[model samples]
Target: MIDGAAKSRKAQVHRMRRIFLFTLLSTFAISAQNKEKPTVQATPAPYEWPAEKDKKYQISSTFGESRIDHFHNGIDLPGEGSKVLAPKDGRVLYRINSEFTPGEMPYGGGNTLILDHGDGSNATWSGYMHLKTFADAVIKNAPIAKGEKLGTSGNTGHSGGPHLHFFIYHPGERAMLNPLLFLNDLYYRDTKPPEAKEWGVLLADKFANVNPDKPFRLSADYPVYIFLQDHGVGKERWGVFEYKVRLDEKEVISTKFDRIFFKEGAWSLATGHKFEDIFYRNLYALTPQVRRAKKVSVEAKDLKGNAFSKTFELKIQQN
Candidate 1:
C-alpha cells in the first residue's frame, strides 16, 4: 500500500509538470504572434479648403513641378487679399514674420505659418506661405480650428504675384505630401491632358534638339530631356503627374511625382537620382549601348488621369 501511494504521488507530479510546460509554450506563442503583427495607422480626417468662401480658386502651380533649379515645393493659389483659412483643426507650431525686415528679400516663403495636427502616430502638418498678414489671434502654439481665418494671401516672399503657397507634410518623416490628395477635387473643374512640348538629347553638355516628327541621329551617348506642361480649367499651366521613357520599345525609366520624398532632412525630387545631378529632374540618361537604339518614346499623365504620348525616331550617327 505504501509503494502504491508513492507511485500515485509521482504520477500527479508528472501531470503538473506537463501542464506547466504547455502553459509556458502557449504564452510564448501568443506573445510571438502579437510581436509579428504590424501596427495599423488610424485613418486621417478629411481636410477642408484653405480659401474662404471661394469656388473659383485656381491652382497656378502644382507640387513636384520642375522649377528653374529645384522642384516647386507647394501648390500656388493665385489671388490677392483672399482670406487664408486653416485646412484642419490644429495648433500653430511656428510662424515666420519676414514682413518687418527692410531691404531684405524673403528668399523662399516670405511669411509662413506651420500648423501641427497631432494625430498620434499619424500626425501631419500644414504650411501656409506668402501670407500678406496674419490674424490677431494666430500666435505661436495657439490652437486653431478648421475654416478659421489664419491670414490673407499675399506676394510677401520670392513670389511673382500675390498667391497662397499651400503644402502638407508628415511631421514624423518631415516629408512633403501632395495636398490634392487631402482636399476635395470636386470643387474645381479640370480635365486637360498633359502636353509633351519638346524632346531633346543632351550630348557633351549641348542639347541636340530632336523633332518628334523627324528622325535624329546620335553617335555618342546622350541623355534625353523632356519639356512637358499641363493646364487646368483656365490657362494656368501646371506639372504632369508622372512620366515614362522608353527606348527600342523597352521601358527604361519611369517615375511618378506623387510625393516628394525626403533625404538627409531635405526635400528631393522624384527622379531616383541625386537632386544636384539632375537639377531639372526631367532628364533621362541612357546607357551607351542603349543610345544606339532607333526609337524612343515618352509618355506623361496629368493629375486628372489624362494621358499623352510622343514617339521619336532615332538613328545612330556614323563617326
Candidate 2:
C-alpha cells in the first residue's frame, strides 16, 4: 500500500545520500597541486520566448516544482502548436525526430533538440523537448539565430499532452536554472503575488488545518505547511521563486527555486533539501525543522518578483 509517511522516509534517506556525496566531491577534486580547475562564470543569457510571434503559450509549470518523487527539471509551456524558436544564438548539439510505439519513446524526450549555448569551459546547454520536427534551417552543429524557427511544439516522448518542456543546464556547474528569468519576451506576465490561502501543520503524520483567527494549543514541536498559490494573467497556475518561514519573528527557513544544483545524481535545493524536505501534499510545504509555534509567519514571492506575507498566533501549551 502507498503511504505518505513511508514516502517521506524514503525521501529522507535519499536526502542523506545527497549530502554525503556533496561533501565527498567538495574535498576530492582532481587537479594539479598548484593549478586550480577552471570554473565557469555563467550568467543568464538574454533570451526571447522560444515561440512564434502570435503564439499564446501559457506557463503550465515552473522549474523545481515538486514532482512527488523528484523536482521538475524544466518549465512546461502549453500552447496550440506554437512555433518553437531558438532562445538565443547557439550551435546545435543534436536534434532527434522519433517514431514511437505505444510504450517506446526515444530518450524519453520525444523529438527533442539540445543547443549549445556556452563558450569554452562554460558549457551551458538548452533543451527543447516534445517538438514535432526541426526546421529546415536548423542543422546539426550549425549555428542558429535568435527568433529563428526551430520546430512546432508537439506531444512527443513521455508527454501527456502537446507542449514544450524547455530546460537550461550548465553541465560544468551541474545546475538547472529557471528559464523564465531569462525570457525577455514571454507571452504571459504576472504582476500578482502568490496568495496564502490557508495555513496548517503536519504533526505526527497528521495534517491539521489551522484557523489563524482562533488560537490553537500545541505542546510539542511540529512541521508547518502553508497553502501558497500563484497565477498568471489568465489564471494559469505557476510556481513561486522564493519563500521564507519564521517563528516568533525569527527566520527559520528560506528557500528559492531560481536554480537547483545536481548533487549525487539528484536535484537538491541549496545544499540539502530534497523534494520531500520542501514539499508536503501540494502547494503546502514549509520547513523540516519542527518549530514551536508562537507567531508563525510566511513570506512568499512569485516568479515576477511580487511578494506577499501572512502571520498567525499560536499558543504554546505549558506542561
Candidate 3:
C-alpha cells in the first residue's frame, strides 16, 4: 500500500500531463473539439444528479466549498453501483480511464469525462472524474441522454474509496457555477440551516473564543470570527451559501458562495475576497475584522435558503 507521502507524489507525477490536457481542453472550451455541431438542451438544465438517484448515496461536498488552498470546484457524490451517468443530454467531448494507464491518476481526479451540453459559444461542460471504467455509450462526441450511464465510479486516482467528483463548467462565464443552484428538482432537499455556536476575536494573530454576555478586553481593531457550522441532508458539514456581518448597526460585510472565480492562479469570491479573507484560519466562514466596535451582529444562510443569525453585546473590558 502506498503511504501518505508516496500517494501524494504518485498523483503529481502520474496525472500532471492528464490534468494539463484536461485543463487545456476545459480552459479553451471542450465544445471546440466536438465531432459534430453541438446540440442544445431541450430543458433548462440537465440538473440531474450525476449518479443513480434510486441508489443509496450521499452528497459528500457542495459547490464552491473550501479546500486546503483552493476552493472545491464541484460537488462530491458517493453512492452504490458506482454508476456514473450523464446529468443531461450532451455529447461526450472527452474521456479518460486511468486503469489503462500505468500510474496513479494525479490531481486526485482520475478517469474523467467531459460532456458539452450546449452549442458552441453557449457551452456548459459537465465534468465526471475518477471513474472505474467508461460506459460503452460514453463515446467521444457521441450524444448521451440524461441519466444515461457513462461509467462506473472508481478509486481511480489517489482516492481512499469509490466515489464520483462531479462538476459543471461554463466556458462563456469562465466560472464554476454552483451545481446545487439548479438541482432543486431532485427528490432530496437540504432544509438545515447553519449553526452559530461561539463568537471569537482574532487578536494579536491568535483566535480566542468568548461569550457575548461577558466583557472582553480589547486594545485596537482586530478580526473577529464566528464558529459557524452547516450541514446538508447528511451529517457532514457543508459551507454556508452566503453571509452578512453588521457592526454597530452598519453593514460591514456581505458575501455569498453562489460561484467561484479563478483569477491570476488564485481562487476568490465576489469583490475579490480571497480564501483567507473569507475564512479565518479555515475555521470560521466570515471574519468581521473591520475596526473598533461596540456592537456586532452576524447573519448567515445555507444553500437551501435556510437562515441563521446572532447578535453580540460587547462591554469593554479594561486591563
* Model number with the top lDDT: 2
Which 10-residue window in model 3 sums to the lowest lDDT?
35-44
What TM-score does each of the candidates earn?
0.79, 0.78, 0.79
Q: After superposition, how far is residue 264 of candidate 3 from its true place, in Å?
A: 3.4
lDDT of 3 at 295: 76
| lDDT of candidate 3 over 181-264, digit per residue (tens) | 766446456778888777667778666777767777766666666767677666867777788888888887788876665455
Question: Residue pairs in steric clash, candidate 1?
Answer: none
Model 1 root-mean-square deviation: 21.6
lDDT of 2: 0.69
Clash totals in order: 0, 1, 2
Q: What is candidate 1's lDDT per residue for 185-258, written digit by digit as tens?
A: 76565688887666567678666666656656766666656668788766767887777778889987677666
Model 2 over residues 1-319: C-alpha lDDT tens digits?
A: 1257866765554344335433432332222112322433457656788887675567788887665456767899886467998888898876766674354422456787878775654556788887877788777899988778898888876566888988887665666778877777457778888887766777786777776566665545676667777777757566677878787777877888877766655667764667777777555565544345567778888877889887777654523
The C-alpha lDDT values of all candidates are 0.68, 0.69, 0.67
Better of 1 and 2 by lDDT: 2
